[model samples]
Each structure stands twice: as structure tokens, then as C-alpha cells.
Target: MTATAEAHATRRRTYGAARLLLTLTALAALFATATPAAHAAEPVAQAAYLAARLRADPVYVTDQLPREIPHSTAPAFARLAKRTGVPTYVLVLPGPSGTGKGLLGAVHDRLGRDGLYVLIDASGVSDATAYGVHAPAADAATVALYELPYDAGPLRSFERFVDVVAQGSEKAAQRAASARERYGDEDPAALYLGPSDRDNQSFLTGVLLTAVPALILLLVPYVRRWRRRLPGAKPGRPGAKPGKPGSAKLDSGRKPESGKPESGKPGPGIRHRLGRGLVPAAALAGAAAIALTASLVFDQTRSSAAPPPTAADLTARVHRVTEGLKRDSVYVDPESARVLSAAQLSRLHDRIRAFARSDGGGPVYVLLVPQLTEDESAGQYDVFTATVHRKLGKDGLYVVADPLGGYIEVLNYGLRLDSVGLDLGLPESIGSGDDQAHEADDHALGDRLDALMTYLDKVPRSDEPNTAADYPATPEPVDSHVLRPLFSGDFRPGLLMGALTALFALALTAGVLGIVGKVLRRRNPAPLPTSTLPFTAPTDPSPSYLRRTAHTELSALAEDFRGSAGSGDSGDSGESGDSGESGESGESTHEQPPSGPSGLLPQVRAWDCFDAAMLLVDGDIDALDSPGPGPETLVAVVVLSRAGRAALRGEVNDLCCGVNPLHGPAVSRHHVRVSAEGRRRRLLPVCESCRNTAIVEPATVHTLLMTLPAPAGADGRVPYIETDGPLTAVPNGIPRLIDKVRETAGVQ
Candidate 1:
């Protein structure tokens, strides 16, 4: 109940303050217009009273002043200061009378407690007819100055600072509600409701801190969604435009593009066909999505707002140093910005002055340029004046700039460098998972360089501005976050934002690629082969009975044809064009036959012969096992007679051997053995071609077939005779043929 009551009271107080501020503003305006110079005195007197009261406060005493005041004015000063407790200085008009001294004494007594010390005893006032007792326009004026750390930036233009406070309060309430939804009725402390103590300083500071992140978050999605809907959305979407300017220009008097079919047309040149393969596109999309999600989840915008150094600012005591040299000024939540206090402000100012005054003050000015929105161009986001330009007079201001494009050029250059990966000693960092983090950092650095260039460019056009240091250099210990890199150090918000942007790009690219890839893969494709090749019979075919008869007949037929052809001419052949024994030659007396068996001879059952030969060679003759030599023990040899060799002399060759009858073996001697050792030899069939000449190998001959007399006067077929022999130097006939067969079978 106490907390709630306190909150309520705070709200009421803010409201009252806002109302009072508004009234004061109205009265001031009225006085300016209606009563003129005479009317300004009341406000001046009121200001003086307020300043006196603020100066006497206990909070301002030891901590602010550290000085003593005259005893005569002590009581009055104390009474006034006790009422306000605000620290402020009252500017009094120089006077020779004791009244002026008394007022100064009273001011000294009250404001002395704080640093709100008065500058009085100025009888040497330069302007004789100033805004004083003489009531004349002059360069100087007596005024009351008060230190109120209430921020009245772009967030709140009116004097109603309370309105800004209210906005923050409302946001806090909403956020609290959101927290409730997510974490249930848990303690608010876990939510990090406000900084340390929920005082005005905490509240204001918290709100300021939260604004930027909130704006970035709220704005980015809005941009993307709006961009997506641009081709489809109605001109006026029937909702309030909010803070957008000239938005109505788009809706009025403009013919919206005709709506296209719901078939969602993508950007120009994007093909409807899905050409990208699934695996690659899907993988890319997944990666992109992950990156995007991470970026969004961890976005922090603070990294984008690091303050730049200025030679003039370093020497100026009128400066305010940022708690962190953070570029971001916006807050993620309003409540976070509401916590700024006068003490904090003063400290910031002192630090800034010290920093600016460290080196000799040159023509330099400090600036608190706020970040621009996404929609605003850099030009539109330019700073209009130096420090507090709109409120305080422009002379001797911080953040001073001439009326030229020099500063803007510098800023743009910095942006460019930051984008292109140049480092300019600025505190910028790449966001985690950000594709363009490096680029952004580069651009920021470029912006600085560009700024320097612009400054150089404008140097000739303007005279050097006055420079002075307002404070001494005093190094102060900063928080780890402040001293660390912009990304993860003190301000992670900026880094997070950068990451999110990169991720969004990745996700978008992936989505697009995925959509296209799926479609493309659906089109042209090379599918896996349907089924495997039909199985072939095994090579070992010597397991059956009926095969022997067929094999013998085929073998006999081959012998008969070869013999008839005279071992040279392609005989009894139908017509396979001109034939010649085109193959390797046998060594010594006999000539080697053509590589292939005679397949075209009519008398020879050619196919049957080949089948039998293959069976014998593959040792599959067992598959045809009937009786006798079983085709396994049988060894066949080609014997070239002298006559048969003559036939091979001409191009019309009938024999497998490349020999002429004239070149045949010397005698009609024939004996062959299967092995060199003469272990196996049998009475095998022999053709007349062999008998015509004595064709015998000396090493192993089991038996010789008698040579047949010249085939019955030339027109007769060569006789076939049986011979006994085992296979000897099995001719180099079929190795190539077997290799082809193996390849077709997919063997190694």
C-alpha cells in the first residue's frame, strides 16, 4: 500500500509540475506581449526567489558549495532555500545601494550551499540601459538560473516536462503488464522494473535509456511490413498515421496500382519455376533464419551512437560529458529515461567540460546530436544548432556549426567509412552474427574521415571560431560497460540492433532462395536408374548331361568348315565381303590364326561352336557333363597344311590363322598334348587342313592323324579326323574378347 500510494503521489506531483510549467509559460508570453518591459520584473523576482530557495537546500550544501555566506542574509536565504531545495543561482543587477548587496548576500547564503554561486557586485555593468532598473534593451539581463536535470528534448518540446514523465509512466505500466503475462505474478524486481531506487532521477534516466531500443524495435518491423505490403495495401489503411509527416500526400489524388491476382507476383525477373535444388536452398534458408532470429532476439542499438571528440569541446567548461561515449540516445523503455537527476546532469556537465578543456581550446564545439529515424535521410537528421540552441542563446554554444555543408559532409564520410570497413579510432563494433557489422563499423569511421575532409573544405570559407576550456581535465573511473567496446561492453543494445538487421537480410535472402529452389528442382531432373540389369548365367556351366552331344557336334562342324576352306580361304562362306586373316602370326613353322572363330561359315554351326567354346574355356563344360573328354580334357589345335596355307596367302582368307598354304608346316606329323609334360592327350577330331601338311609340335604329341590326300581333285571337302592331344600353349586368341565380356558384366 505504501508503494502504491507513493507511486500515486509521484504521478500527482508530476501532473502538478506540468500544469505549473504551462501556466508559467503562458504568463511569460502574456507579459512579453501585453505588459512589455515593466511586466518582466515579476517573473524575474519569482525566478530569483526560486533560485534562492534551491541554493539553500541541504542536498546542495556540503556536496555542491563547500563555501560560506554572510550571516546577515543567512536566515532569509535558508528560509527560501528550504522551500525549494533546488540548486540555482540568481543573477542580480549591479547596484551601488545596500539593497543589491543584501540580495547578493541572501543569494550567496542560499545558493552557496550548492554550486549555484552568484556573480554579483557588478557595478561595472557594461550596458547602462540594460534590462534592469533603467528598463532598456541591452546586451545583458539579470535573470534567475536554476539547475533542473529534467530533460526537455525532442521527446517533449513544451515546458510540460511532466508530460514526458507521464508517457514514461504509461509505458512502464504497459511493460509491467507484459511482464505479468510472461512471468506470471512474480516480483517486479526480477523484471528489472527500474534502476536501483525508483526516484525521479532513476525514472528519467531509465526512460531515456529505453527509448532508443524501443523505437528501433518498433520501427524496423514496421518498415519491413510496410515495404512488403506496398504493392498491395490500400492508400489509406484507415488507421491514424501517427508521427509520420506528409503521409497523407501518398493517399490523396494518387491512383493506386491495380491489384494483381492473388498469385503473388514477386519482384521483377524472379522466375516462377523453381530451379534451385532443394538441399542447397533449404540449407541456406535454415541458416539465414537462424541468423535472423538470433539478431532480433539480441539486438541492441546503443552501439550506433558513440560521441566524437572535438578540440574545442575539450577546452570548454560549458560541456556535459555523456555517461558513456555511446552513440545511442534512445531508450528501450520510457521509464528508463525518466530517472535522470540534476546531480547526474551536473556531473555529466563537469566531466564534459573537463574532457573538452583537456587540451588547448581551439575553434571547437561539442554537440549532442540525436540519432535520426530510419525514414529520415542524413540530411534531414542534421543538427540545427549547438548545445541547447533552441533554448539557450546560440553564442558560445557547444556543438557549433557554420551555415555550410561541411559538418554534414564529415558526418556522411564517417558513415561511408563505417559502412566500408574503415576504423577511425571511434568506439564502434560489429554486432554478433551481423553480416554487415564490419561494414557498419567501417562506415562509421568513414563518417569521421569525411567529416574531417568537410572541415578542411570549409576552412577557407570561414574564420576560426573562439575556443576556450571551461573545466580542468580530471579523469574519472568509468563502469566496465563504458570502458568496453560498444557492442558488448557498456552498451550492448546497439550491437544487438546491428546483428538483427544482418539476420533479417540473411533470412530474407534464404526465404527467397528457398522458394525459388523448391520450384526449380521440381522441373528438370535426373532420377535414379529404375532397376538393375538382368542377371547373367554363371561362367562355370559344366554340371549337366545333354550338353556334351551338342558340344561335340559343334566342334566337329567347326573342323569340317576350316578343313574345307583349306586353312586359308574363307570357305563355304555365304558372303561377309572379302576376308583376310587379319591377326597375330604364330611363331616358327605355323602361322597364327585370326583372333575370332570362323563365325560366317555355313557348314560350321557358328553360334553353336562359340557356345561350346565359351563353355569349355569358362570350365562350365561340367554343366554339360555327359561322357568322354567332357569338353574339359579336350584340347583343340589348328594345324595349317601347306595347301591350307596357300589359301591364306591371298586376301580371301578362310582360316582363323594368318598363313598361306605355301607357308604351312614342313611335314604331315601331328601330335599334341594338353600339358608340356605330356600328362594329358586324347584322340581328338582333326580337320583335313591339318592332315594336308605335317603340323606337329615337337614337345608333346600323343597321336598323329594321317594326312588326307589332296581333297578329291580340288572340289572335295577336307576330311575331319580324330586326334589325341591336350591343350598346349593355349593360343593368345581370346584375352581381349574376355576383357570386353568382363566389362559388360561389371567385374573388376
Candidate 2:
């Protein structure tokens, strides 16, 4: 054979191989797009396929987005994975914002290990999932990434995550809660969507809404009047009173000899009247319908619901969305469930993808929503699933997982969901035999799906889609209190509440204004219309300043006595040099009494009462800033001085005021009350000034509050007159105590 012949043969073989490849590709494409109507060309969902590689290695990184997340992150991920205590697997891949949980779940299913699975997307969005692991791996991961700086690297976030999980569940949960509050409960928009904000917005919208109908109704009459005013129109109703304004104007121009003008063309006939009535009626009906629709739409999407569906609502809602489910594989009723988290839904997407393949069974459709209640339509589980299956007409597993219900159910129709492996609904299928090891994550939707997917691998397929289904028993209802929703499909409850709030506020404000206006009208009322101004004439000034001369005089005298005691002598000479005592006690009785303490200084050195009073006056300033040289000290000083001088003059002493010893001398008796004591008034010696004060401003009257009575505990410091304690019985007791002390000193 020649060289050209050989080359031609090689070309022919290459062309044949190319033709076969093209033919196979064309056939595959045709079958994929045409054979299964359910597999309509929709958006292709991305999935995480790291289980095989991760089984061999604890850490895996996809270099698909090499520029975004380099392969070098593997070592860092590995280091952090080892620190999680429970066995840990780490994967770094290009996952968009919300796909973290789903990605990890898919990987976890294939790996089939009880460990903490950490998945980090290239953008540093991540989550940690745990299957039968004794660790707070999930919350730790949630909190750690949330706590780190917004632009932190994936490895760095993972490092913080390891630290959080190591701290244990309590701390991890607390931190997770804190992280939840870092931004807010929901989004920042929720800040503006709070109860108060909702009320305000609802009020404004409600007012605007209410006004629109009113305005339309108001315009109906005007619009009809304007249409009547148009040229060649009936000026007034037929067979109307000719005396009416528009009716008479037409009759005045054309009245005949009888002057009736044919009653304005016999009014309108029955058909015309009926037709006229129908227009307005139709308009009113249309207006009412518009308002109703607007109200319903608002009601449907009001209160940005914070709450998930209730038990009954959940079951009924599943029924409501069955028709929707027929059209689309995924029908997340915006009403019945709390918005499923991005990660969890993405995970459900992964399982759906796995089940959807014929290699397993036909394509699977996983319905993810919060089951409002565990006790569903009794006896309806079998019927409901069958009814849904018949409607769908698909040979695949229908897995329904409610995060709130805490259980996953499978309604297999031709999809061998339970035939090939352990049934997810059966507790014993967990293989641990210990029921507690079964994923008891009843409240966590992600957790329930995670457990379900563990037993759900590639389900074996069958041609004549037969049913092999399992229904989980009704779970005990989970307890949750839903607050005012941030955004909900139901608006009436919040609207009614807001309307009530507006009404209450309006009523309160109006009531207050009315009361205040009435009171103000009686007091500073609007004056009668007068020519002159409603002003007062200028008045002369009369202001007085109280000197409190007694306070200063007593304070000065006490200071002088203190100075003399220290400087003059700490001796009895001040008392021994009395002028009349040695001369003649009888002669001394005839002399006039000295009034102030300075005059009695010669005897003060021997008077124990005077000495004690001086000691009290010199005591330290206290915490309460109470005016010291209290009544007890002041009374003792004045009484002792007066008593000493009286003994010199053979006269009776008049002590200072009993209520307030700061007032000079008590020349009269007055009635008063003491602090915290019974309100009963008492007669006591008081100066003219104190008497006036007790009469006019009784509360300002001071008392000799030296000590508390027995009724008051030792710690209680009720210092009121009449209360018993260590101090003398005020001004009256002072003189008696002084005289007793004088006799004890043998000076009498």
C-alpha cells in the first residue's frame, strides 16, 4: 500500500468516529428534553459532590474557583477540623451565599459518618453540621462566622468556629444568640418593621385606603351632576315639580295657556330609570370589590410574619399547595412556613437532585416547610399522600419534611425509597438500637432532612411506579410563641390591633385635652373682648430677709467657750471665781439673771449639761448634711446657761424653744407635731418665731429629734420629739437635768 492510501484510510476512520460521537450526543439531548415531561428544561441547580474525596481525606477543597479560594486553605481547614473534638470533615468549594447547609448535607449523606461536617464556600459563607455527634458544632459554626469580621477569610472563620465548639454547647448557644442579635433578630429592615412601625404604617395606609373609597363615593354625586350639566341633557327629572329651580326655569320659557309645560317631558320611563339606577349600583359594586381586593392583598402579606404555621394551619396549608406542587416540584407556601433558611433549602435541593436521577429512582421531589402541627388530619396521611401522588403522576419518592414537625415522611410511588435501604420513618433503622441516638432534632428542619438523607442513598427504580410508603406517627407538638411578625401574609390581626391602638391614643389625647381645657377655662380663662389689655398693674415690692441671729450668736458663743477652755485654762478656776457665791448666797438671790451662755461662763466649767452640749456641738459633720448642733445640743446649751445664771440669781430658768432650740428663748407655749410621730398635736414651749412657723407652715416646724423610740428598731433612726432615747427630754428636760447635775456636784 502507498503512503497516500494509508493517510486516506486514517482520515476515513477519524470521520467515522466523529459521526458516531455526534449521533450519540444528538440522541442523548433529544431524550433528555423530550422523554420526561416533568423534567422540563428549568434552571439547572448546582450541587456539592465532595463525599467520595472527603471519605478518603478529612479535608477537601475544590479548585474550581482557584482565584477566589486557593488550594492552600486545605491545611488551615484540616488544622481546625482536628480541634473540633468530634470527628470533623471540612470542604471548601465555590458555593453562593445560601447553599452552605445543603452542600454539607449532600456531602454528609455520601460520607455516611457521624461527625461534624464543615462546609465553606469561596465567599467565606459557611456552616457546621453534626450527625449524632456530642458537640455544639452547628451553633458554633453559625456564631463563629457571624462573629468574625464581615470580610474574614474562610480559614480564619473556621479557626474561630473551632474555638466556639470547644467551649461547649452552653457557651456556643449563648454566643450564637448574641450573634443573632448582632445584626438583629431578622434583617436591619426588620428594625423598621417592628410593631410600632407596623402600626404607624398601617395607620397611614389605612387612612389613605379608607379615604380613597370615601372620595370615590363623594365624587359619584358630583360626577352625575356634571354629566347632567352637559349640553342637550335633561335639566331636571321628568314629571318633577315645576316649582323646583331647574324645572321651573324650563317651564317659564315654554309654558302654554295652562302654564304646566307638560311636566318636563313625562320624567324618565321605567327603562331609563332602571338604567340610571344600574350605573350607580354597578359603580358602587365595583368600588366595593376594588376595596375588598386591596384589603385582601394587604391582609395576605401583612405583619412580615415572625411566626410559623400553626398545627391545623400547617395540615390545611399542605392541602392548599397540592395543586401548586403538581405544577412545580418545589412549592414553599409563603404563608404556612417561616421562610426556610437559605442553607436548609439548598440542602433539600441536594436530596431532591439525588432522588430525581433514574440511577437511584426517578427524580425525587422533596417538600420542605414547617409542619404547623404533628396531629394532622386524622386518617388523612395515607389519603393525602395518595391523593398528591395521583395528581403528580410521577414515579418518584415524595419526601415531606417539616422542620417544626421534627419528622420526615416518605410516600414512595415506584421510587424504591424504603425498599433498598433502612426506612427513615422507622426508629430501629438507625442501627444504633439506642433510640436516643436517633436524630432527635425535632425542631430543626435541616436536622430532620439530614437524618432522612442518611438512609436515603440512590433509591432503586421500577417501571410500573408502585407505592411503598411510610408515615411517621404524629409527633408531640413543639412549643413556640410567635410574636408580632416582621413580615407575614396575614395582615388583619395586626391591622385590627393597629386600629385599636390609634383609637385608644386618639381617645386618650382628646380626653386629656378636654379635661385640661375645662380646668384652664375656669382658672386662666379667655377674657371677655375688651378694649384694654388683660394685664395687671405694677405693684410695690415687699421682701424680707430672715437673719437667724440666734443661730449665729449661739454658734459664736460656743466657739468662744471652746477657745477659752483650751486657752484660759482646763481648770475649775473659771467656775471657782464666781462673784456672789462666796460674798453671800442670799445676796446673789436678789441680783438679776444673766441671759446668754457667755454671762454664765463663770459657772459653765462646773455644769455637766453645758459641757455635754459643748461636746455635741463640736462633733463631726455627718453624711446626711443634717443641720448639726441639733435641737438636743442647742437646748442643752441654752438651758444649762439659763439654769446656771438662775442659780446665781435665785430665779427660774426659761430654756430656748422646745421644737427648735435655734430660736432664742421660749417665752410662750404652743401646739405642734413631731416628724413621723402620730399626727396628734402637743403643747410645748416655743419662741414667737417657731410658734408662727408651726402655725402657718407646720411641716417646716423643727423638733428636738435626738433619738428613736423603742418601737423603732436599733438601726432605725427616727429622730422626732416625744420619741424616747439617750437624749434629755428637749428644753424641759434640759433644766431638770442641769439642776440634778448641779446638786450632784454639791453646788446647790
Candidate 3:
């Protein structure tokens, strides 16, 4: 099988096992609550009855006596009997009952008392009374001596009656009786005659019991919603200014700012948090107050009252049975004869006999008690079981029934001893037989007995020796019952409320922390600085110097050309002198130019140097050396000028292949050269194929050169250049000169 099928099967098995365990647990609780018949009073009565039987005492005192008779009182009784020459019988019963008189007569008949037989009914403080049997005939005075005193309490009156009888004081008894009569009747409402103390609850107590849990359930959701909204007061939209016609208004009729609260007033978030915090506090306080009030009212209203006469009778019967009192018949129903007809009783007896004769045979007895509550019937059943176990040597099945309560209990004793399978396996095989029998419509005592017999008949008769392994293993306890409420399929208002309350509480806590953090941060602002930039000098000054040198060379070249043109060549010797003078002046200018008036030489020289740098870096030195003016040449100049020579150098340096000035690579080490001729300078490439071409100035190159930075420094000092003669060599001389110019210009 696939994993999913196996998992599903495992889950199904787990659920089935869990369901079976819950059913068993519920059944166990039902049994425990319904059958509380194993009362402590039974054992005490058993010990007392055993003591009485062994001593052969005619005066039988049940264990239900309110207090033990003083040792002096017993001696007084003995002395009175000795002096009067008459035997007395005393019977102390728990409460008044119809059989009290009969019991007293039976004891008197058996003991043959001559003086008197006394029966004390101790049902309640106000109802206690004494009766004397077979006493001497007396006038009102003598009869009064046997009566209780009106002024005295129940215990005191009993003592007074005993004292008067012991002293034989008729006059004193008459006075006491007259005084009791003068005290009048006791209040009936002060007495307690119910089966349980639970009957004393007042109406107010009932109302509070229902109200507290309901209130808690209702408040939980309200609190949770309030807390959930406590984080921030969210506006309808962003950048929605306050006092606008369309904005939402605050409680004060003024529009609230987005993300801000009103001055000197808590925001909606704060108010919500405070309200949420108080909800649980109020609910808990209310619950505690109600609980305290109920407790106080219960304590003040409680009374010390005794159980009813019927409960006392039931208890006495149970004790009697516990003391080995067995009836001659199979059914014992004393309340009414119509409960079970003669034929039904006969049929029940036959069924019991048949069960004894069958496999795993054991005698069965049925005890039908008067109607009692389920709890009361269970107690009686326990006592009956003990009594039957004692008489039948712990080897019989006893069925006790309370027809009025419509309940029945089966007590199995020695079934396991006779046959393990019958004891261990029979109960499960019966399958809710006792419950079904009790719930039957007829609810007849005889019918319940028949049902029990039918259940017993189904018991397996296997006599084969069985080991512990033969039985199915006990199942592990499951927590499925704890989770049973969650799967009940009913709406749980309390659980929902509790969940909402928790969610809101968490939100409130987070919001409060956030607000506190903002306040703390505002109180301690960060420090500011005195200056924005750090003071530092340039690392390299070569480019600055080269720029100045290029300006000086261009200025002197321009100045010499202008001076030669304005003055005209005086002679060939004069022209040679001027040329020689200009060469000397150019060489001197290369070392350092003289400070003079502003001229265009510096600007033109800076532009020429910039153009040359761009061509070399762009790997387009051949175009600069071309004699013809073409579109390619024109495009390069326009691109360089628009982009600027520094920007052009950066762009070409990114695309070039060999090392060159302005940080680019070329196909040759000295791929491009600058040519200076009298008043003009041009760039040329040293390619072997382009050695014969005459260099032409492209308009784009000239325009591009105009955008280069002028060779001027902040200090106005011309850059010093080192050169031996005019720059005439096309390759080695021109490049060295340009390098010197760039170094002096500081064009990094």
C-alpha cells in the first residue's frame, strides 16, 4: 500500500481506539455515580450486630446513636433494675419509623421484660420522643414522670426522663411535664427532613451561577476588538491634510492630522489600549465578587438539619442485611405487593435455579428494595452484596433493584474463581445489558431479574485452563477525551472570545512599547558635526604642471608668429635671426614662459593637446593623420567636443587596446604624434602606410579641442617644460613634448 493509504488506515485505527476508550470511560463514570451503595455505615453496623449477637444482648443499640451513653447512666439503669426487682429493655434507633413499634414488641416478647420496654426515636432534635411499654397503670402524676420536659432540650429532656425514672420521683416528673407543655410546640420550619442538603439552595444563588460565565463569554470579544485597533490611528489616505473638506473629523469636530494625535489629548490607539486592559480586569473582579457573595450567602443561610425518616429506614435495612439477616423467599419487596405478581416471581426463581445448574454454576439472589435515588439505591445494593457474600460464602451473583428509580445493579463475586473466562469475558459479551434492563419500559422488579438471568445465560461455559495471554491486551489511555470538546461541532462562544481577547492583548502590548520607544528616542537626540568634508591635498601635481606648460608653449608660439607677421621679414639673415630667435624663445618658453598679457596661444595650445589625447585614447590616430576630410573625421571631432576631451578620453580609454597617454592602449607604443609647425599644431599617427600623408585639421577635431580645460592654475604660474629644440620629429620628439605638457598641466 502507498504511504497515504497506510497513514489513513493508522489514523482510522487510532480514532476507533480513542472512541472505544471514551465510551468505556463514560460508562465507568455512569456506573460510579449510579452505584454508590458501598457505604461505610454497613461495616460499622456489621461489627455492632456481630458484637450484639455474640453477647446475646436483648437491648440492641444501632451504630447510628448520636452520642454514647455515659458510664454513670448505665450503672444507674442497673441499680434501678436491681432495686425495683424488674428487668428493663432499651432500644436506641437512629430515627422514627413505622417498624419501631414492631421492633420494640419483638424484643419485649423475646426478653419477657416485666418493668418496661423503652423505644427512643432520635429522628430530629424537635421530633425525638420516648414510649414505655408494659408499665404500671398510673394516674396523671405517674404518667407525667415518663414524659419529656417541655423547657428542656431533646438531649436534656431525655436525661431528665431517665433521672426521674431512676429516682422514682413522680411529683418531679409531673412538674417537668407541665413545664414542657407550658414551653409550647417547636417550630416546624427549623427541621431538615430532605434526602440531601442540595435542596436548600435559594433562587438568587441559582441566578448568579448562570450569569457569571455568560458575562465572561460576552466581554472577551469586545475586549479583543478594542485591543486589535490600539496599534495606530490609521487615516483614510496618505498625505490627506487636516482641515480639508473631505477628511474625516475627530470627536472634537476638528479634522485630525494624518499620523498625528490632537494636542494634550490621547489618540484613539491609547484610549483603545486602556479600555482593552480594563476589560479582563473588570471581568475577573466581577467573577470574584459574585463568587464571594454566593459563598457568604450560602454560609449565612445554611442549617444543621437531619435526613428524613425514609432515608433512616433504608439505612437500617441495609445494616440489618449486613448483619446476616436472610429472607426465606427469592424476592424481597416490602413497599408494595403489586410491583411483582406471583407468576413473575415464580418465573424469576425458576430462572435463577436454571442459571445455578448451568455451566459456571453459582447461586443467584435478587433483592428488591423500596424506591430510592440512584445514589441511595447504589448504597443499599452495596450493603446487600456484602450481606449475600457473607451468607453464601462469597460465591453468588446478587441483583439489587430499585423499581421506582428504574435502576438495577449486578454484583459478581466468585465467578472469576470458578472460571476466569466467565468473569473476564462475560461482562463485555453482555453489551450494556444492565443499562438496557434498567431503561426498559416495564421497569418491573421481576422483569429486571429476568433480564439479568438472560444476561447470565449467555456467559461462556469454557472449562479449559486459560492463561493471561488468552485475553486481549488492555488498551493504552488516550487523550482523545480531552480534545473531545473541540470536536463537539457546536459554536463555542467562550473559546472565540478568549482567542480574540488574547490577540488584542498582544496588540496593545506592542503598541504601548512602540509609543514608549518613540518618547525615549525623542528625549535623547543625536549630535551634529562642525564640518562636512575632511581637509586633504591632492596626491599628484604632475597633470596640473603639464597643463600650465602647454599654455606657456602655445602663448610664446603665438606671440612669435604675431611679432614676425606684424614686423615682416627684413632680410633672409633677419628671417633666420627671427627664426633662430623664435627657436631660442620657444626653447626658453618650454623651460618656463614669461608672465605677460592674456593671449589666445594658451587656449589654442590646451585645445590641441586635448584633441591629441582624445585621438590617441580612442584608437583613431590614423584618422587624425589622414590628408582627406571625410565624414568619419568630422563625426569624431563633433563627438569629442560635445562629450568634452576629458569625457572623450574616459570613453576611449574604456575601448582602446594598447598603452597610450590619457590611460588607453594602441596598436603601437607611439601610435599617435603631435606635429608643431610655426603657428599651428596637428596630431599624426606613425603607421607605415600613413607616413606620406599630409595631416589635415578636421572641423570636428577643432571644435572638440575648444572645450578642453585652459592651462591656467590658481597661482597663475606658467608650467616649466624641458626640451632641447623645436618639436620637429614626427614620433619620438612630439610625443615626449606632449607628455611633458600633460605632466605640467596636471590632467589626471
| Candidate closest to the true structure, highest TM-score | 3
List residue ranges in candidate 1 displaced over 4 A: 1-340, 343-605, 608-622, 625-748
**TM-score for each model:** 0.19, 0.21, 0.26
Model 3 lDDT tens row, 1-748: 6999999999999999999999999999976754233322223332333234323753443433212221123333344334322355444443322132244434443444444544433331222122343223222222333243332223333344444455454555565566556544532233222212322233334344334544554546543443322222112211111121101111111111122444676654665577556656776776578657756654422222221223343345445444432543365433212245556667887888788887776677666553322122323445445544554554566566654455566655555323444345545313234655546433545555676678678766545422222221221121111222111222244345445554565567558756764564343211111121011111122443323322222222222222222222221111221211112122311122223321223323323333333322221222233333222222223222222222212222111111111111222332222223233543433222122222343222222111122143434222111112112122242334344433433332
Give the per-residue lDDT of model 1 (tens digit) for 112-219: 443323332112111112111221111111111011111211111111222222234354345435544654533222211122222332223333333334344444
Better by TM-score, candidate 2 or 1: 2
Which portions of model 2 miss their true places by more than 4 Å?
A: 1-411, 414-433, 439-499, 524-748
- Runs with alpha carbons beyond 4 Å of true place in candidate 3: 1-55, 63-86, 94-103, 122-157, 164-169, 172-180, 183-185, 188-351, 358-362, 367-396, 401-748
For residues 1-748, could you state the per-residue lDDT of candidate 2 as single tens digits? Answer: 6999999999999999999999999999976656233222111122223566777788876532233344545675788788878898877654432252355665576678888877776445367678878888778877765666543556666788888889999989999898878855443222113345544544545444434444444444444554333221222232111121111101001100111223334322443476467656765675567556645644423222212334443344345557677766665533122324455567777766665553545556666443321123322344445545654666666666543333456666665444434344444432222344244422444545555555566344444545554544343222222223323323445445545554565556557656755674443223221112111200110111011221222232332333222222221112212221312221211122234463233433223333333233332112112343333333344344434323322334445556644333466777777565567776777766667778898865544422322242354444434443223455564555555433322344
Task: Give lDDT for model 3.
Answer: 0.36
Q: Which prediction has more favorable lDDT, 1 or 3?
A: 3
Error of 1 at 69 (Å): 55
Query: How many Å off is the CA of 576 in candidate 3?
Result: 99
